[model samples]
Target: MESFKSILSAKGPSLFLLPTWMEQNEYLTAGFTSRNGGVSEEPWASLNVGLHVGDQDADVVRNRQLIAEAIDWPFEAWTCGEQVHGSDVFAVTEVERGMGRLSRASAIADTDALITNVPGVLLASFYADCVPLYFYDPEHQAVALAHAGWKGTVQQIAIRTIEAMEKQYGSKPEQIRCAIGPSIDDCCYEVDGFVIDKLQPLVQELANLVNSVPESMLTLVENGKAMVNLKQINRHIMLKAGILPIHIELSEWCTGCSSDQFFSHRKEGGKTGRMASWIGIRER
Candidate 1:
């Protein structure tokens, strides 16, 4: 019953696809990329889709293009954001459909989330240990991607993306299907007081709203630190925003634990490449 299923291709990039979403709508292509099947070299090793992570820009773009080809999406439709780990969500339009695919300068700036109802426009966001949040509104045919590191999670970027979808595409939260993609899990994500401070209030608020306990989302460890479950916290935010529990899919692939298949910033000491989470409605 795993929501994200791995699909290995001999000719192109390997992917972890959200099968239910693709099954529900054949025109939809939604999945996370594995750090395999690309043209980049060491640290980046293979499939690094991030343009700003010190990898050669051409290599990154080639990797991204390989992904686009693997998914049957036009490389020109591959769009992205300049993630700043904030709660800002940018509503992508037709005019901005292909920005940031080739370089960081053309990408949507200072945004952690990108939503679009436009067909043929791929919304992609890069991640190392950060969480990748996916939102799809079947009724509106809109898809969104959010990059939620601890900072963005604390800022409630999940809620911001849902609200933006509601405002821009009339997407009712209850009708919105969400997915939490591969990232570092609580088992491998230990943080200091600085992060815990930001998370505590949000965890408390979520507990009060859901009638649960804050400890369910965070575990205290030695030296004023905690092992945080960012994916669960974001799921709670989705619930608090009115997305039904049945409508959300959570992935169990932990980047830190599965570093051979993913690029883990924590496991690799901040010098790793990035994987991409992408969602788009293919042109009919």
Candidate 2:
């Protein structure tokens, strides 16, 4: 079954929700947003929650507010980072809550991942063709969000997040639930030798964990470029990091293929809006 289920309404912002997770824990709110039903114009056309993508800050904030309202989360609880496509992980405290919701300057600087055990603090990250990784530790009631592009993936941002959770919240990997949200898939993500070379070491190590060969994670094609399955690579990384396979949920929605529903930097030639992946435990 698809992990991220679409929630659409004629007059409301479109969202893709993790029904299973929400059903398992009523206080938890986790999902991704689609690029429909916002106030941005032209390339941003609709629901663009990224404040750094040159979209009108007012429009982006409104879009984010719409998502918060739709999910019944306080807009003030929305916390985010100034994603730099690096492996840096920031552990958000209550003080950091709502930092980047209104503007980029207030966002956590130079971080690609944000983890927090603080209830009511919504952890959100923007994405356009890059992977959105979600982590939840029900035992500790902690939730996290990571933005993974090729750079972050090769840097092993997933492991960094899990380790951070372990250190900050005592979250055991076996008890951690992880979900890979919509992004550019191998079908749409082609990389050159520079990227493939960076992935080579990790792919070699991942081979021992997966049943299939490393090629399943990174397939080399003609002209010296390779199709990188970032989602699978992340899953394997999670597995290697001790997260159970059953605890991992992967989405099939490809941003490149679903331009009508997502923002794809590659498919849209870098001039595009962004969708958000958010996870938080509502305050009681």
Candidate 3:
């Protein structure tokens, strides 16, 4: 069964929620947003949650506010990073809450992951076809969100986030729950020699560690290109980092294929709105 459940509302942002997480803990709110029900103009037609995507700042802010309202989270609790597509994971504190909610300058600088044990501080990251990685350490009451494009994936952002959680909050990977959200799948994500070359070593390393075949992670095509399954690669990284196979939730929604529900950077020719992946523990 697909772990990310779609919830369509008459008004407010459409969402793909992690039902098990929500059911197990009422204070927990974690999900990815769809490209519907917000206030933005073309390219960023509606529900664009990114500040630096050439969309009007006011419109982006409004769309984010709509998401906050939809999730019943205070717009003040919505925090974000500058998302440089690196493996840096920033530890968010109360002071950092709402820092990047409205503007890019206020966001955590040069980071692709945000982890926080602080209750009421929502951590969000923008994506358009790139992978959205979520982590929750219930024992420590911590949650994290990582934005992994090809660059971040190659840099092992998923493992980096797990390491950050362990270092910052004493979160054991065995105890942490992970979710790989919607993104472009191998079927729609084709890479040339440059990307395939960079990925090959990492895929080999992961395969060796997990005792799996490297071919399962990447498939070669004509002209020295390959179709890479980033979600599976991230999952393998998580498993190699000590997270149990059963503890990870993988979403089947493909942004490249579901253009009507998601904004795909590749499918849309680099001009599109961004969706948000958010996770936070509410204050009681």
Q: How far is candidate 1 from the true structure (C-alpha RMSD, Å)?
A: 0.9
Relative to the unseen true structure, what is the C-alpha lDDT of residue 65 in candidate 1, on a scale of 0 to 100?
90
The 10 consecutive residues of candidate 3 with the worst lDDT sum are 9-18
Q: Which residues of candidate 3, in runs, are more than 4 Å off? A: none
Kindly report the root-mean-square deviation of model 3 from the true structure over all alpha carbons.
0.8
Clash count for candidate 2 is: 0
RMSD of each: 0.9, 0.8, 0.8
Clashing pairs in 3: none
**Which regions of candidate 2 fall more than 4 Å away from where they truly are?**
none
Clash pairs for candidate 2 = none
In model 1, the Cα lDDT at residue 263 comes to 96
Model 3 TM-score, all chains together? 0.98
Ten contiguous residues minimizing lDDT sum, candidate 2: 207-216
Q: Which tens-of-lDDT digit does each residue in 232-263 have in candidate 1?
A: 99999999999999999999989999987999
